[model samples]
Target: MMITFTRILICFLLMVMFSNLQAQQLFQLSDDYIVKTYSERWELDSVYQQGTFRLMSYKPIYLAPVRWSSKPNDKPTSDNPDFSSTTSFPYNNIEAKFQVSFKTKLVQGIFWGKGDIWLGYTQKAHWQVFNTGLSRVFRELNYEPEIVFKYPVRWKFFGGQFRSVGLSFNHQSNGRDLPNSRSWNRIIFHMGYQNDDWIITLNPWIRLEDEEDENPNIGKYIGNAEINVAYNYHRHQFYSIITHPFNQIKGGSIQLNYVFPLKGHLRGHVQLFEGYGETLIDYNFRQTTLGFGISFADW
Candidate 1:
């Protein structure tokens, strides 16, 4: 137990060590090669809040109970008649509820002409942390590492600033093997626009075909693209993620988020999720869940 805790501590330290380096170079002026200061941007209630991922809809650290609306139909790999998928999972899922999530950009620099590169990582874990009756196991952990190339653009539509355009390659997986493993790679195009307190980004992505199909039917439930819209007012941040299923049969997921300052460097976070894609294991299972936790940064 002590060894496990030590490892987790080490990981957190490494994440912070790398993220701090990028935070120093975040959102800098491209032409002048000078760093962008917080005073140049809009004033915030807290200086600690001035960081990256301001317009991105996804945040970290959400812990709450989840109820499955439609449980997935089990698939059997072995052809035994009595074979059941639930044999590996006999515990009551209704009692499992906990989460630890975070994202950080490790490094960023000017890459080429008028463009920059950033390396970032985000992880989401569903923990039965408090469910001691179930041996307090971690249910699932999904790690995503992405490298993005961002280029500033001078364009406007709907009277807003067309801030930047980004292209990236992202890979997401649970790092598990065999029956429970899930992984995918995608190419994303990001177009960002901001008007006053409102920020919107359209992320159109295409999944790269793979030789070994882990979750073959994932596209039907998670869809081909995502849209993020966020509005900032005073010290509050509101955001949402929308996805429409490719087919009418399997539904998509919609997540709503609200974050406000609770104390110094600490903010109260509320997450409302409906439909699918709540977790990798529940990618095809429809569910509704609400999580309440604290976040250090929305970026």
Candidate 2:
């Protein structure tokens, strides 16, 4: 009777183990299909995620016209009836920017985690055609490469919501092709909080570069801070940005951008920038500009 009881107990244990293994296999298969289906749906909604390897390119043509007036008092002369003279100049400008970028998400995990790397190049050419028949052209080129790592924060500060943080390292350079060309290394920390229609991003970045005449007064160590806020309503998005520099020599810039979607995949961008200190090339101290561009991204 004891031997029979032992054999029966061993058989029961083996059957339970086999049943658990079958259940685990079925669960895994179901989970995998769910992920695959979600990925396909996401791609259909946003063409930006359509491909395993993605490439995007943009070219923009811009025209700018500006007028400046100055008044000067010259030494009183017999031929001159008035001591004050005014001069006004109207300048016509044209600028072109071309950019190309490629990105690939190398790894994706079951826990909604992903890793990606991107490389991009941008070229800008500008021409100034003065009414006085004088013309000048300038060109600039930049190359950037970056890697990013992100994970869900899983903690809520104000309310029960979803949030995430990411760390990235980027290298950008002008390839010494332009005058005063230099390279910079940047470390960026980004945090985002999303609650329904509102999304907020706080980005604090540090930039390091070797001392060069290009950035003379600004020390080799420079810090930058940016805050970005976006509000989404239905299919529309509005964004504003503020940037601050730690060093006086580096200056600061503020921008507001609005996007409106049109038919198909085309979208329009209207941007305004107000800068102080050396942020602007022409005004080295203070400058303001308004610009508009078109974007073709997944809506």
Candidate 3:
């Protein structure tokens, strides 16, 4: 099954690359890409704007009413003996999942007007709304807050434009106590590139050790590096994220998202995920999930 999935993924990526060639010749960034994913995302075109309270979308915001998991981590455990859980919860395989993320500029034109700093926050939750037997409890929730410093770049790499580079201090946690608790801190470096309808981002992070660590083996499961690739074809969008791509032996995950135009700015979204770290509570658990929903914002 893994081999079959890997083959399909390779074929899908090849098709995207072929389509990208045609897209580059026919479409230009000046023609106004729908989302303007990279430029507007990083504020690459503009330096500083005068605003007291302006928040921007930092990641995709969507709610999936129907998300099915191949395996539910009813009894979550950790490599750290002290963090392992002995309790078991009645978690349903089907649930509702949603994510909300946003960012705001904190300091404009820092470091002699070469970079800007932003504060960002993201929250994700899994709710077993259909599992009324368990009183419709929330299965898991993860909170992430970060501070990033971004610098605009104009370098060219293999026919693509290197748009921006950034560094961020990120903190992610489930905000729970004891055996169910999960948290981590990282110093992440970011690099973004754009070529016509495609946008690529590379993130390599360093884990900051805690004296009272909750999940010391998190780096092995959650990974040290990740890559995001996005392609836009008219009103349709395709996105893929691969973590620990270079070192799959340590465990990795692949997430694919397809967004199609529905009505106006609303979009129909379909997501497929496999491998580990679907949620903080299930960080070391391996699973495959499929979700169908609507998307309000793009990453």
Candidate 4:
């Protein structure tokens, strides 16, 4: 699996590097989170217009939906019933079929010229909201926070315009301790470019070793880089995120997202994902899933 995924990634990189490109264009920054995502091609938007951050558009508004994972994973603490109900709560959860998911950034802004910083957080939880037999227990919740700095760039590469570059510090965990604890941190470098109607972002990161090493070797499974490519056509958007390890390829993840304007302000979204790392708890697990929902932005 890893080998196959790596090959795919290599081909993807080659194609993007050599692809003919013309110009760099992104939506101008505004007071809407959804608009912010599609307006600017990169997190560091000052490259387009260096100015103050506005209200309401501080970060992403909210992206909420339900997802179904074909493959389920057990918690390090649960999936085994010996402990049954611990002092924390009720019985251990058996992976639920459905989940309530959403991720939103807290705040982001540019404090000075050419340099901007951002603070963001996201959460995803497994919920048996419909199953009455199991009393509708919550399965797992993964929390993530990240701070980033983006610098506007003006350069030509691959016959395309380089738009932005920056660095970020990211942390993800379940917020549990001991047997249930799982967390990791990363220092990531990102660069952005645009070609015709396409926006491209490349990110390669290094995992900061944890003293506790919970969910060790996550990088081996999730890879060291994440690439996002988006294409725009009228009122439709098509995007995909891919990650892979070059040395070994057994584990990796690919996600494709489609957004089409359904009406005024609301857009229909469809997501198809295969492989691993959809959530923190499922960081080392593998699965293929299809999720549908309404998105506030193109993603």
Candidate 5:
């Protein structure tokens, strides 16, 4: 069964990539200042004794205007940068991401019925093109592979209520072809309380061995904490997340996500994230980033 599932996933990924390739060419040729992005994510969880399994997959496409405004003194603006006064075309940024994850578990309960534990793995790939509409076009790719293990905690708080704890390991690095790669290893501890209508998760994480271009000392050890709140009303779901990063870099980020059903089996997601961070892949120092995305969702 695992083999069959893997085959199906591979086929789906190939089709998605092929479609992106076809669309990319057309987007590149278009005269209008436009940027396009795509993303895909998949997740699976199962329990053998409980005979329960869960699967989720999502794909989203985004299109945005490509224009940045700059001052006459040569200062660049943000995503929608202002180039109204000057003849120089503003730099355009384009990016895309793809992610997949799967998990399985088996459990047996003592007092009531049974409980289960699960393990999952996730892979994410991201591509970015900087200055798409300008003279210099720089492209970069990032890949992350992660693993998660989850187990249930019997009622310690209230009756008919349950808690879950999970441990996750993640490795992030640049694609092999990229000249400069930033890599990090992180270990995360997550605790969650779940009921029918609401779920709240707290994640605390630490990082070890941070490097840029494989340099050992260039990176700093950091700690991060995150809180996620999710509420479901029928088929619609709402979620918000707040993250705090500490150590050499100090800042926080907040994001809100909404999922709504669309036609057929398709669903849509509207998400926004705003925050300031010390370092982004290429930028030497800290910077602030504000962005929003619309995509397909399976929640």
Candidate 6:
């Protein structure tokens, strides 16, 4: 027990050491590079001028070599027996994970130059890279594609600026066959606010009625809404995502992340997640996970 404790302590110490080292370079910005405001980040209200069809980062693109889950779901089960896995596989507690997310402007200045439309796609995968005995199979892969129509708002709320409101059609799926398949669709409403370096977003979604439900109880576990908070301080970024069902808070999740600059356009990322819905296959399985790696985008 002492040895295990020591190992964990060492890992934490190393993370702190690297963060400090990388922080030194975070402040060294180029002459032409300008720090962006919350509105500028989304190019809202013509604050940041951009053309259509330009691809941009929608979410944090990251790869973690070490992602440890306290409880690995080897046998994924769902309320729908057709979507539950029949056989259990050997899933490692520690594995590699990666995510890639991007967005492109489809129509700019629509609705009499007040609205914009975007198409976004995000994919995240878990790989059992260290479990060579299982021949290094990909444990789970989730794909999300969304279409958003966003409009900038300029309302004041407690000295903060209400920045934007939007609606999104989102589809998330594992792209798998029966007994391992999981998928869901949602109509999400988005609202964003900004106060100095702090940005907050609320996304409330309703599940679309499907003839053949993949996971009928997914909403009970993954929640119907998300609250995201982000703050930037001297080139260091901190973010948190909280989700919970409206009926109760027992089935929800919280994820915290810290990111600091490492190199040009590259940053070190550390993430901690607790509860359900870390992945599509693990939507109903609760776990605590810690991951350390690098990311190319923020939020």
What lDDT would each prediction earn against the true structure?
0.58, 0.42, 0.79, 0.59, 0.42, 0.81
Give me the runs in candidate 5 sitting further than 4 Å from their true place: 1-100, 104-140, 156-162, 176-179, 210-223, 246-250, 276-299
In candidate 3, what are the lDDT values of residues 112-170, reduced to their tens digit?
67687887777799999999999998888887778788888999988989988999998
Query: Of the pair 1 and 4, which is ahead by lDDT?
Result: 4
Model 5 weakest lDDT span, ten residues long? 34-43
Candidate 3: worst-modelled 10 consecutive residues by lDDT: 25-34
Candidate 2 lDDT trough over 10 residues, lowest sum: 71-80
CA lDDT for candidate 4: 0.59
Tell me the tens digit of each residue's lDDT in model 4 across 1-299. Answer: 32243344335433432442222311222223333332363444544443332211222222335566665554333322331234443322233332222222224454454566654444556665555665876656665556667777778878778777888887767665556556778999988887767778899999997555767667778888998888777677788989987679688899888877776767777778898777765677788877667665344
Which candidate has the top score in lDDT? 6
Would you list the clashing residue pairs of candidate 6?
Answer: none
Across residues 1-299, which tens digit of lDDT does each residue of candidate 5 receive?
Answer: 32344345445545544644464442232211111111001111223232323322221233212211121112222221221123333433333333444333323242234333333434443333344454443333344444555555645454324466667775655433222434556788867665556666788887665323342322231227778777767656677776665564545666566765555434456555555321223222223333333333322
Clashes of each: 0, 0, 0, 4, 6, 0
Candidate 4 lowest-lDDT run of ten: 22-31
Decide which is better by TM-score, 3 or 5.
Answer: 3
The best-first sequence of candidates by TM-score reads 6, 3, 1, 4, 2, 5
After superposition, which runs of candidate 1 have C-alpha atoms over 4 Å from their true positions? Answer: 1-112, 246-250
CA deviation > 4 Å runs, candidate 6 = 1-35
Report the candidate with higher lDDT, 2 versus 3: 3
Q: Model 2 off-target regions past 4 Å?
A: 1-102, 110-138, 160-162, 176-178, 209-213, 216-223, 246-250, 276-285
| lDDT score at residue 289, model 3, on the 0-100 scale | 99
lDDT, model 1: 0.58
lDDT digits (tens) for residues 2-72 of candidate 6 = 22433443354345335443554433333212235767667896758586655556777789999999989
How many Å off is the CA of 56 in candidate 4? 6.1
Ranking by lDDT: 6, 3, 4, 1, 5, 2
Per-candidate alpha-carbon RMSD to the true structure: 8.0, 20.2, 11.7, 11.9, 11.5, 10.9
